[model samples]
Target: MPATTIHFVRHGQVYNPEHVLYERLPGFHLSERGVRMAQATAQFVAENPATQSLAAIYSSPLDRTKETADIVCQAVNQARRVRQEKPLSVQFDQRLIEAGNNFRGKRIGRGDGALWRDGNWRLLTNLMKPSWGESYRSIASRMTDFTYEQVARYPGQQILVVSHESPIWTLRHLLETGRPEHNMFLRHAALASITSITFDSSTQKVLGITYADPAGGVQ
Candidate 1:
């Protein structure tokens, strides 16, 4: 049976100075180092045989994700141009967005306007089900929906998807462990990393999962 692979990429570091929880917030873009990280990953994708001939490219609607996806898409297209292949553009999808959080736009430190202040600590009850803005199950459900749709759309091919850490990891955890609930602090999805999942094109059964971090050493 033919195989299909979906490479899920986590967006690079943001330009947040105050260290606020910028979850799902607009106006947050990638940092200077983040651009280099994305460039490294783009180059990796462009040179890697498994991903160079990507059938499609997708990204979360957030600014950070869009920026990273644009960089990768440009690199992929440049490589495709050399082979005289049709170029692919980055398609935005809301399902690939960052996990919702009640702490958005708030710092996680002590004192005024902090996440722990003004009885906000009550939301820290459970990290598994996560008593926060969005449950892990919800994030995984949306991500799974998106992944299955793409798998069917581009059978026997490989595609790239740029998404946030939570959604990507949550879906992976759900598929691999049969549970989406996990400790948020221990997520394996790193910045500018690629988590690829392969499936049987005809049966849609998961074949395997792999990971790579091209920008792991980037400062």
Candidate 2:
């Protein structure tokens, strides 16, 4: 059996601060710092061994992720840098979008979110049982399902996925231990963060975890 490698990245920060939430807003583009973060992340991928193995790149259809993917593609342009095949072209997919939330258009920093009475967004555990947003299980299911399906189809390919915070964290939880606690506590993936998971088609064991975030890593 062979192995499948995936490079999953969370989207950079959006330019909204006064908003209560931004569930699926179309115009929520990246902030200035976010641009730098994405640029650094792209550089990391560019110089890493994974770049040579990357068979495809997929991203959430949101503007932030789309833009991040574009910048990263530039870094992976070995066609210009090392005279390899054409540069990477990210394939946008709606299924990679964050799990649906009631915060569709609500401002995030107004008064208080249902779970976060202090204005900030709620933690995953606190938000887990509330109807204020989508359930953790629902998000976990979607991300993992799509990931597994992608791996099965691509076989030994290395892939990259650009998506949002929650969805990316949920996928990491599923990949790491597949335990309930990882979802509830251990998974705290950040904006513009990169998390890698490898699956051996040979032994069927999901091996290793290599995570990094140039902008404040995991804080």
Highest lDDT against the true fold, candidate = 1
TM-score of each: 0.98, 0.82
Q: Assess each prediction's global lDDT (C-alpha) against the native.
A: 0.93, 0.73
- For candidate 1, list the clashing residue pairs, or say none: none
Worst 10 residues of 1 by lDDT: 104-113
* Cα error of candidate 2 at position 97, Å: 0.5
Per-residue lDDT tens digits for candidate 2, residues 112-137, read 45335544354433544434567667
